[model samples]
Target: MSIFERMKQGATEAARKVEQTVEISKLKSQISTREKEIDRLYARTGKAVYDAYSRGDLSRSETEVMDYCEQLSDLHEDIKLIQEKITNIKLEKSCSACGKIVPVNARFCPDCGKKFPEDDEKPQESTVGEIRVLCAVCGTENDIGARYCVECGNELSPAAGDRSKPNDPAGDSIV
Candidate 1:
């Protein structure tokens, strides 16, 4: 092939890969959203079922509860499949200790500090975003949106500029 032709082909291939990566990221985000929805449905269904039973109301069957459970199960399965695809695309592996995904060539798992077995795959760019917030107390990295530290249960304040300190009228005075 001519040099120009080869260059054009490479550029097209690169663009295709970028589009694929974006699609995968989108799928991962959707999976996260779906999982949250399943949690909400679980809580709602539980309350509905409990309220019905506590009131001696047998009019409502298990249909709603069954549906919620089925949906949750399906969402979990879909998440697994999407995770598999992400792992395949990123050439990553799940940490044995914590189940957190890490690059295949990593020597130590970032989440759990578990050492990884030596592998042949060279390290590629991490697919995970650098959006996690570090816990001030325990130092465990939590989601940027997490309101509480997952490891130590400490209440997290909003990021800088997002939270305002309590106003002190006296402290603000000339004293």
Candidate 2:
């Protein structure tokens, strides 16, 4: 074949390969989307089963499902604890009157105008040597006077501790 003809043939073959690659990428994307949809459907089905178990509609005779339900319960508790830690890190408190989140230092709830108690006015102080000062961001135990966490280098609050006071009505405790 002539040099020009050989070059044309090579160009056509390269074009075809590019088209095939594009098509394969499109197919893979569609497959990934379908897989995500399937995962969501499975989650919904699991939620339905868990709801039934919680309502006493499903008995403990099904040991497999009971185990799954127990795992879900533990996961839910873990989620709650993590959420409380997040709230503490944000220095926020829920208003008792309206359940609206407000700044920890606020004397009254901005949304509900509910006055916070005297003990809730400020973050409770950490008694030196009596309690451990843990970094809220990294959960690393630090010395009472340490300004930052050693493990993650996250800043530790001076008043960080079990914020719950003996007189706190809600009796909220932080770790």
Candidate 3:
């Protein structure tokens, strides 16, 4: 082969390789999305059942059991399709968000708009528990649960030395 022909062939092979990799990555992502959808459907079905049980409504659950069963049947087909797509992928860089192939360590998915799918991005769980307090005076509560009532503007949990009531500017008249 001539020098030009050899160079062109080499370039063509490289381009083909890149194309294959991208196609494979896209296929994997598509499969991941589909599988996630199937999982979500199943979860919803489970939740519906649980809710029926929690409400002590056996009759309603029985009526809806057929619908849930049909959803599970549909999910099987979805899983099959996703598996086929996964098998066809030629390259793999699994997404962290949903566990599937990406074009590279891509920052965002061109297909799904997911950011940093193949990287650890889970938020750290907070260790501090929520705080709530009840006021013993004026029967009003504050969001900060401060030692004072927000509605009536009364100081809460007053010290014994400060137990004396303030002089009423309105002449101590009972309204």
lDDT tens string, model 2, 1-175?
9999989977986786587566656655655565565555557557767877888876543565566566556555655665565556556678788886755665554444456786876562332235455667767555544444534546555344223322233544333
- RMSD vs true structure, all candidates: 12.3, 22.6, 23.4
Which TM-score value belongs to model 3? 0.41
User: If scored against the real structure, what TM-score would every candidate get?
Assistant: 0.45, 0.35, 0.41
Instruction: Give one digit per residue, the lDDT tens place, for model 1 in 50-144.
Output: 87899888458377788888888898888889877777776778877788665565555554456666663465643344677676787766655
CA lDDT of each candidate?
Answer: 0.68, 0.57, 0.52
Tell me model 1's lDDT, rounded to 2 decimals: 0.68
Number of the predicted model whose TM-score against the real structure is largest: 1
Q: For model 2, how many clashes?
A: 0
**Can you tell me which runs of candidate 1 are displaced by over 4 Å?**
1-17, 57-63, 98-100, 105-175
As for candidate 2, its clashing pairs are: none
Model 3: lDDT equals 0.52
Residue 11 in model 1: lDDT: 95
* Model 3 lDDT tens row, 1-175: 8999989977986787698678777766776776687777677777878888899985666656677677767766776766555544432244445564533323443223356633433232221234433345544323332333433434444221132543345635223
